[model samples]
Target: MFFTRKAFPVQFNEHLPLNTLIENIVFTVFDTETTGFQVASTDRLIEVAAVTVKGCQVQSSDTFRLYVNPERQISQEITELTTITNEQVAGAPFALEAIEQFFDFVQRNETSCLVGHYVAFDVLVLKNELKRSKFHLKKLQHIDTLDLIGFLAPSFDMRDLEKYAQAFGTRIYPRHQALGDALTTAYLFVELLGHLKDRGYSTWGDLLQVTNSPARHLSF
Candidate 1:
């Protein structure tokens, strides 16, 4: 039987000390593939994937990927972009159950923060899904790689992930696949942190100072 959101009693996240070393913090860099961008109402998650970054390293062995059965016909356009077939998710776990497994993965890794490119949208997608079950997510600590890129290059206009990865000389991965994008973002995230460190942002507090401005960080 599927459990309600509250039935999962794992502490998958924590508010770390401000002075915590950046190397000591575990970051869950994640991505979601959805039916579309209208997450607040119609769009639903088709896939969710994350990779763990610890001590300035991407732990390739530590990864999580889940295919969520949206229970609705996926549009042909979305299927083309994400290459996710109705058949693939037909027998997959529903949103709540898949998310529970995701939380379990996060709990096992003891993640301190979540990272994504334009992460607010993905968070919203998750929020709306939980709201369907009358559940809600607590305020989460999240960082956007897009914001980091903006910080590094304020005049850069292209907001595309692949573009940023290319410009930054980071590893490029298969587009639209959830896990592949997560891995790409993981490498990009570590590369961005290296740049931040060069600019004297090495501690959790230092990182927060730069990223905590209004419209900089997303709280769920």
Candidate 2:
């Protein structure tokens, strides 16, 4: 059954204390493959993937991946990029079921914030999906690895995930697939975290300060 907003209330910890060390913080890194880029209408998710990270390492056992039946035809361009086909998702669960599982997976830790590459798009798609299910996501905190990379390496061209992975030496096996991209984001995040740590940013507050700095503007 699809969850209603009242049934599954997500809690946001945006203002929560961030005194804890980064090493002890739990992060739920995720990625999604969708039918298209238009989040305001029509587009739907075809796949979702997530991994839990702590102490700068991914918990191999703690992962989530789901192929969702988008209920619409996928474009050939999208298929070429993500390699997801209608036949592959024909027998899979629908959006609501897959979203329920994703919520449960991330909600395992209340303090865990979401991490993604160009995360806004993924979040927008998830929000739209939840609205379809008559639910809404709580205002949760998130970190964008793309933004972090921009802040750290301003000279690097922020083109695509492949560029970021190659520049940072993060392995992206089977690129464009949900799980593969999520794993690659996790590795890139860990490396970025190390850079932040070396720059004396050891707590979530410190990281947020940098991310929200007025001087740091992100493009792409």
What does candidate 1's lDDT look like per residue over 153-207, in tens digits? 7898787889988989999888999999999999999999999999888899888
Clashes, model 2: 0
Candidate 2 residue 148 Cα shift, in angstroms, is: 1.1
Write out the backbone clash pairs for model 2: none
List the global CA lDDT of all models: 0.84, 0.80
lDDT of 2: 0.80
Q: By TM-score, who's the top model here?
A: 1
Error of 2 at 188 (Å): 0.3
Summing lDDT over every window of 10 consecutive residues in candidate 2, give the lowest-scoring window.
211-220
**Candidate 2 C-alpha lDDT tens digits along 1-220:** 8543533465533455678788878888899999998856999999999988889887757788999999999999999989999899999999989988887887775445788888888888887887777776555778888778877898887658888888888767578899988988888889889898998888977877767633222111
